[model samples]
Target: MLYWALVFFVVALIAGVMGFGGIASASAGVAQILFFLFLILFVVAVVMRLARGGAR
Candidate 1:
């Protein structure tokens, strides 16, 4: 998931450099959403692990 966010961020950067405003904006939006989602999931996993006494 983090990888995908990076991918989209690269895409957005390239598109912006190429002056493709619409595509750049869309890709940037996707990247932002993916990054936040990844963060949320990571936090949840950590919380769950700690709750389970850090078994893993």
Candidate 2:
């Protein structure tokens, strides 16, 4: 998931450099959504582990 976010981010950067505004904006949006999803999942997992007393 994080890998995909990074991939889109890089693609967006390249597209922006090439002046493809539409494609860059779309890719950036995807990257942003994926990053936030990944972060939310990570936080949920950590909270679950802590609740189970599995902290390390």
Give the alpha carbon lDDT tens digit for every residue of 1-56 in model 1: 99999999999999999999999999999999999999999999999999989965
lDDT of 2 at 12: 100
lDDT of 2 by residue, 1-56 (tens): 99999999999999999999999999999999999999999999999999999987
After TM-score superposition, the amount by which residue 36's alpha carbon in candidate 1 deviates from its true location, in angstroms, is 0.2
Clashing pairs in 2: none
Each candidate's number of clashing pairs is 0, 0
Best by TM-score: 2
**Model 1 ranges with Cα > 4 A deviation:** none
Clashing pairs in 1: none
| Residue 50 of model 1, lDDT score | 93
Each model's lDDT comes to 0.99, 0.99
After superposition, candidate 2 runs with Cα above 4 Å error: none
